[model samples]
Target: MITEDQLTSQEAIALEEKHGAHNYHPLPVVLSRGEGVFVWDVEGKKYYDFLSAYSAVNQGHCHPAIVDAMNKQAQTLTLTSRAFHNDILGRYEAFATDYFKFDKLLPMNTGAEAVETAIKIARKWAYEKKGVKEQDAQIIVCENNFHGRTTTIISFSNDEGARKNFGPYTPGFIKIPYDDPKALERALIENKNVAGFLVEPIQGEAGVYTPSDDFMKQAKAICEKHNVLFIADEIQTGIARTGALLAVCGNCTCEGHCERQETYSRPDILILGKALSGGAYPVSAVLADDEIMNVIQPGQHGSTFGGNPVAGAVAMAALNVVKDENLAQNARKLGELFRAKLNEYIKDSTIVNLVRGRGLLNAIVINDTEDSSTAWDICVALKENGLLAKPTHGNIIRFAPPLVMNEEQLLDCVAIITKTLGDFEK
Candidate 1:
């Protein structure tokens, strides 16, 4: 193994460019280490992590409690497939189900896997329980949904770049306008074979396009009216990243009592990933009451490393840190402070149009057109000024720092961002 001290930032990026696939157009900052709300470059320059691995490090980067749990579990026991029961799987299932208020949990290894699992479960539930014809059950999805990059998940995506050459797409999905109750109700009313409506509580990959305050609750009501399942893909919004235990909880702050809140519209199917391990392990899960989850029988779906010992320990520890540190409440306070700061700058900025988001999951619309390189350039400048952020398609730059950020650090980041935007003022 080559020591990181011997590698320059340019050398490391060049190596990745030559060896790894060019699937992502990353900003030119090579992060070598992360702790709390900050990360370090190979040359030892520290920078605030504005993106937080696309909200996957909500508990902050490399938290010692989480790392320690993983190390201990790795040394003790790591893997054992479902062929035979493992010691930690049962504990993880019970702990997580209770934590999220679900009846059962099915483990997976990635966000995409968990999404695929939910789709399968929804389809199976449709056929087995809902009296839908086999292989004909349809799931309603939003037009600009960004569940994952898997072939099937991308089938319904409107992005030309992610869909262009990938063909032989999966069928059985109907698209509707996001955040509109009328559109959702119409789809369910028109499609008698619809089984579920999958949605992100807040559309993170779609430039943090948070819908109307009533969109989630309204959608759930519509689904209920049609006996359709309301599935929430919370892979990017869960685990206190969105100022609540779950975004679907609205303004709820009580540990995990989302179902008790008047605004909470509990999902028939809940998918979680990303921060489940605090970015320490590849852990994801699909949760539901027994009635929905029981559709998956033996040999229907399984991942070799899904519910292994290390994942269980890491996830449990990661969740504990979120609760112990009050990351959700912290995110709520910091997000309000961040948006207020940005709004003040945006009023006078020629480089930014507006800012919008809930909690730390926010975005600034560049004053430039969608096709311009201004957002990318601003990001490059931000990196030079001691912060790291990336743009979502076109001119929208998302700002999602780790939930561990304090008011002082948030203010510092807000200053860096506003100054960077000013540098591009027309």
Candidate 2:
């Protein structure tokens, strides 16, 4: 019966260990508060948040504008299940569709749900519009992609850890090597039943494996030639996390005004989550033009809280912050500075191999074997030194701070990161 305020960090950890599901292996720090680019441990020590909740808080923690919108909507009207009409859904739908230059959007609660919705849409479009036989339509996915842990998503995932005991898996998916346009082209040409090609513009979960600049553009071209839907899962890499509004925008620095860039690759179906609500609420969406989105009718796919009033209000405010503050531009500028600073330090370093990523979403590979605990130990040291980041794929440490972080804060974080890595150097 101990109150939350009275519990120590160890006590809180112990409580979660006993009561919570043992799915996530979190860092030992027990955080109690956050603001902007920083979070505080229960003991009151402050640390820079480099992970940004897997790029969810790209606008930063407790972003005032997003939080204000969520709070106001929560006080006024929270949820009016899809069974009935709400006051804010239509306005949000219109605003979002225009913002992203899509003809329509289907709201959902989480990244996995949005991905599933997009899959369903693609399949339906194939059956009804593309003349593919029902249930015979196949979606193409890339290796090392991490869309989500949902049953349908994991069915196509090559990550044995996620798929190990979770079968009989969902079929109708073909896996191809990532970043290889030739492989993609071959897959599409070899399979006429392919309905869509689902890919992460930059593979964020597989240690921020950013592809070549023209990869997305080429993939979209190939999909277009084959009449396949090019679905971009920007759950972790979108919303200015990769310097652009969406990773599929390539190197365009037009911020959120994608119309100014002709080189950007527009996906047939774009799945977005994480930063969509600026971490204030769970709001994910699947956006496509009417030709592709019209496949689904009422009761075909939806969540009770999918397009709730609070989600609509919070998403609009969150998106407004991205454009008004020029977060995409900031991420682009800071990301260059971060990689430059790290590269300078890495020239003489032995324990660090290389840094790869776009914009604020970057990762450094430890020079040790993947099975080595070197990266994890370095992260533990980083925590003690007042910065927070996590290791991915064992030896790769992913660093994604909020886009709102200032140059001064980023330089300070870089210093901490280099100093921490220096300790583990051979």
lDDT of 1 by residue, 1-426 (tens): 236467888998999999999998998877788898899988889999999888889999999999999999999999978788999999999999999999999999999999999999999999999999998999999978999989999999999889999988999999999998899988888888999999998999889999999899999999999999999999999989878999999888678865568878899999999999999999999999999998888999999999999999999999999999999899888999999999999888888888999888999999888899988988999999999999887999999999999988899998898888888887
Candidate 2 positional error at 311, Å:
0.5
**All predictions: root-mean-square deviation over Cα?**
1.4, 1.6
The superposed Cα distance between candidate 2 and the true structure at residue 290, in angstroms, equals: 0.6
Name the runs in model 1 displaced over 4 angstroms: 1-5
Quickly count the clashes in candidate 2: 0
- Please give the lDDT score at residue 293 for candidate 1: 94
Best by lDDT: 2
Runs of candidate 2 exceeding 4 Å displacement: 1-4, 255-260
Per-prediction TM-score to the true structure, in the order listed: 0.98, 0.98
Q: Tell me the lDDT of candidate 1.
A: 0.91
Residue range 1-426, candidate 2, lDDT tens digits: 235666788998999999999999999999989999999987888999999999999999999999999999999999989999999999999999988889999999999999999999999999999999998999999999899999999999999999999999999999999999999999988999999999999898899998988999899999999999999999988888888888888777674446557669999999999999999899999999999998899878889899999999999999999999999999999999999999999999999989988899999999999889999999999999999999999999999999999999999999999999888887
What would the TM-score be for candidate 1 when compared with the true structure? 0.98
